[model samples]
Target chain A: MNYCSDCGATVSLKIPENDERMRFVCDTCGMIHYQNPKIVAGVLSVRGEQVLLCRRAIAPRYGLWTLPAGFMENGETTDQAAAREAHEEANATLRDLRLYTVISVPHVSHVHVIYRCELVSDDFAPGVESLETRLFHEHEIPWDELAFHTVRKTLECFFHDRKQGVFPVHNLAFTIALPT
Target chain B: MNYCSDCGATVSLKIPENDERMRFVCDTCGMIHYQNPKIVAGVLSVRGEQVLLCRRAIAPRYGLWTLPAGFMENGETTDQAAAREAHEEANATLRDLRLYTVISVPHVSHVHVIYRCELVSDDFAPGVESLETRLFHEHEIPWDELAFHTVRKTLECFFHDRKQGVFPVHNLAFTIALPT
Candidate 1:
């Protein structure tokens, strides 16, 4: 941060007392602007034998397929965020969402927590963020065209668990390769 | 935030294009400063029948008992944060940390991601944030004096699951009492 939000004073980067990391500290107010990773909550929703997927209308992966998910806003629980995202992206209401996969994407400073949700009904249409929304069976999933690794991992685990007749919570981490 | 970090200009709180919520958007540089919930990663470490606890030396709950946990820093995974918190709070190393409980405290804008860890060795001491560190058996736990509800929940789930012989990941949401 260039200036403190509290006092509008210029900020300096330094390690605070009893701290190991450097932070944007306001000289006047002594406010330490600490930046932490964000939580991205989403759901891998199901309807009959199909899984829900939304085609992105936004950039960074426009037209690519993904589950309905987005940034977890303040004052909302992770599951609440997931269900809201479902509505925002696909106009879908989720029910009985179980904690499924938690993935940490350190390089991007984001964590993905996906829930296995059941669609409340078949009434769903694409919201503004999605070009289109559809459901896919296991054989119809566009594996190579998926938007993110976390989504791929969650789907793979869901299918594997479904085949094995046990659905244990999966925790995984993904690190992007540093540019050489 | 008052001033934009990108251009040092005053930021206006407004809903950006297609965004549902208001964000601090810089008029000059067009930077949408979005804020999201953070993750607090910690471990419920065990050494045989005892679980580790650290008495806080910091404010907010000075001298109250808690697990070794803190905010998940940037560029590190949640597991790494848990491991680091273990070392930083209790001067202890951990291994075999399985993801146990995920609790979202939306009122505080934080999610607690806890793991069940094994103490690497018996050599332990308090770090700067902890006044004292000790292992507490189930009967000796300071239930009334715990620092946070998330810590209490994790410990309760651990003991309950231990008795049940089935350790499934628990997902819970805690709401702070709204001011009247």
Candidate 2:
């Protein structure tokens, strides 16, 4: 941050008194600007043996397949955020929402929380941010075309657990791969 | 926020195109400043049959009892944040950390994530932000003097689950009650 949002003054990175970490402190107002990891909430919407995926029309992985997910907004529960992402990306409604995976991506400062829920019906269409929305069975999933590691991991766990007829909440962390 | 953190420009609240929420838009640079909920991570550090508690030495509930938790910072996983909080507030080290409760306090735009862990040793003292730090048995807990609802809920779940000999992760939400 070059300027302070609170006072419109130049901000300098410095460790405040009684604090160990360096923060963006305003020169005029002395306000500390803190940046935290964000939550990306979505769902694994299922119908019979199929799971929903949306083809993104936006940048950063456009045209790639992903589970409907986005940065969670303020004033909403994780469950609510997950449900809203489903509706906003695929026009899908969900039932019996249960927390599934909470994956921490420290490199990107994101915690992706995915829920496993049943599709309300087979009726769903691509929302504005999606080029297309469709359901795919385990065998038909575009594994290589997946947009993110979080989506790929969640799908892999879902299919693996389906065989055992039991699903458990998974806590995972992702580290960025360094070039050898 | 009154000014853009990117450019030192005055900002106005407006909904940008293709967006549903009102966000701070810079008048000069047109930067969109979006705000989201933050995660507060802490630990329920247990030693024998007792859990650790810290008396606040800061504002918003100074002198009240609470678990060692604060706003999670960037470049840390939830588990790491929880561990850091315990050490920072109570000077306590933990082991066998497990995800416990994920509670959404939407009214305040905060998600409290508590982990259940075993205390490494009985040697713990109050850190700078804590007035006092001590282990408290179930019967000795100061229920009426608890600082936040999230801390109380996690402790309640821990004590109740102790009887069943199982500690399943909990997903919960808290709504603010309007005063009559």
Candidate 3:
């Protein structure tokens, strides 16, 4: 941040008193601007034996297939955010929601929490942010065209667990490899 | 926030085009400043049949007892944040961390995530943020003296789960009553 949002004064990065990390401290207000990771809430909405996927119409992996998800908003639970994303991105309603995968992507400062839920009905359409929304069987999933690693990982876990007729919450951390 | 952190411009809250929520928009730079809920990571450190608690040396609940927790910092996983908080507040190291209670406190826009872990050693002391650190047996826990709702809920879930010998991850949301 170039300026303090509180005082409109220039800010400098420094370690505050009794703190070990460097933070943006305002010159005038002395306010510390702290930034934390964000939660991306989404859902793996299931029909009989298929899962819903939305083709993004927005930038940053545009046209790629992904589970309906987005940055969680304030004043909402993670599950609420996940359900809302399903409605907003794919015009889909979900039921029987259960916490599935919680993956920490520290390199991008994002915690992706995906819920495994049953689609309310087969009456979903593409929402504004999606070019198309469709249900795909496990063998038909666009694995190579998936938008993100978190989505891919969640699906991998879901299908593997489905065979055993048991689903367990998965907690994971992912790191992107730096260029050699 | 009164000013844009990006350009030092005055800001006004409004719903941007194609958006449902009101966000601070910079008058000069037109930067949208969106705010979201933060994650508070903590731990329930166990030794034998006791769990650790820290007395706060900080504001909001000075001297009140709680599980060691703090606002999660950037570039860290939730489990890492929980471990760091235990070390920072109680001078405690933990092992065998398992995801436990995840509670969303929407009134304050915070998600409190606590991990159940084993205390590494009995050599522990209060850290800078704690006035005292102590281990309490289930019967000796100061239920009414707990600092936060999330902590209480976590402990309640833990003890109840311990009896069944099955500790399933609990996902919950808490709401505080507004003064009548």
Candidate 4:
């Protein structure tokens, strides 16, 4: 954001005449740049009573298990992103995929949208980004080793909903106290 | 990702002897880096027959109308993120927020998760990030001026579901071709 896209001039942070908060405004073109959070979508595909999970083969949290998920791309909707991730990571085709959860993690600059998908086929294998892939029954879930907090929370909610037979909708956030 | 986070040594993208894909592996610390897409969450708060919409005060699509939404935080669940965004952008408290849509926009690096929230209070003003805020009944919506394609699709789905009184439980992504 150092250089202005409009006029190629250096941008500076300043409060607008009518507003109190600071904004990155271009000195030459008067363009104000505003950055917003990105969206990530994925699917929690299930077969019978088992949930599908993928072990990462890449960085950030390599070797950790996660649902098949990815960032939304330009010109694509969130559901397409979820299905594409599932197809790419696990080689799974999902049907009747339902919206499961929407979690916002502002600090990390991401919002996670997870879906509950029914397994349409058992045909699956590790994609380019996966180290290993498999299914786990509820009791056999690797709760202690799940990769991301959002994935963990989605699983917890799924199990609870299954047990109660009443999927109570909720929107909540967990503030992670990162070590400074 | 080419340098080791632990020892600051050069890392290499190496294919495991037995595997097919390349992986970024640190020789000194044996750490592997894997990057994945992130999730985004937002809420569609409906009051009676009208829905809440906000004009963007930020760029990428500034001044266009959109749903109140943002990214998920580290420790929060999807539901939490949705509610938080609703409160922050609209100053509106929500109750019985239900999962509405999971859209994947892979080309843009995000998955958008939207929820249908019940507006608990009418007390609201423009948040720091919004240019303006207002409620629009179905017939009054500015369809052509909507900010994002995902937002437009979500609203369409909401109306479709409203008509049937039977919300389809599935993730759907529309591959939209935006004018460059």
lDDT by residue for model 3 (B67-91), tens? 9999888889999999999999988
Candidate 1: tens digits of C-alpha lDDT, residues A103-174 = 999998889999998998989999999999999999999998899999999999999999998889999999
* TM-score for candidate 4: 0.62
iRMS values for every prediction: 1.4, 0.6, 0.6, 9.1
**lDDT of model 3 at position A99:** 92
Q: For candidate 1, lDDT tens digit of each residue in B111-177?
A: 9999998998889999999999999899999999999999999999999999999889999999978
Q: Write the per-residue lDDT of candidate 4 for residues A1-180, one digit (tens) a residue.
A: 455644446678898776545777878778775555556779889899999999998787999999999875545566676898898898999998667776667567676777788988778999989998999999999988788999999999999899888764444455667789
Ranking by TM-score: 3, 2, 1, 4
Model 2 chain A scores worst on lDDT over the 10 consecutive residues at A171-180
Ranking by lDDT: 2, 3, 1, 4
Superposed by TM-score, candidate 2 places the C-alpha of residue B73 at a distance from the truth, in angstroms, of 1.0
Model 1 chain A: lowest-lDDT 10 consecutive positions: A1-10
Clashes, model 4: 56
lDDT by residue (A1-180, candidate 2, tens digit) is 999998899999999998999999999999999999999999999999899999999998999999999998999999999999999999998999999999999988899999999999989999999999999989999988999999999999999999999888899989887568
Best by TM-score: 3
**Listing every candidate in turn, what is its Cα RMSD in Å to the true structure after a full C-alpha superposition?**
1.5, 1.4, 1.1, 7.4
Instruction: Compose the digit string of candidate 2's lDDT tens values, residues B102-145.
Output: 99999888999899999999999999999999999999999999
| Model 2 alpha-carbon drift over 4 Å, by segment | A177-180, B177-180
TM-score-wise, the better of 1 and 2 is 2
Q: CA lDDT of B144 in candidate 1?
A: 95
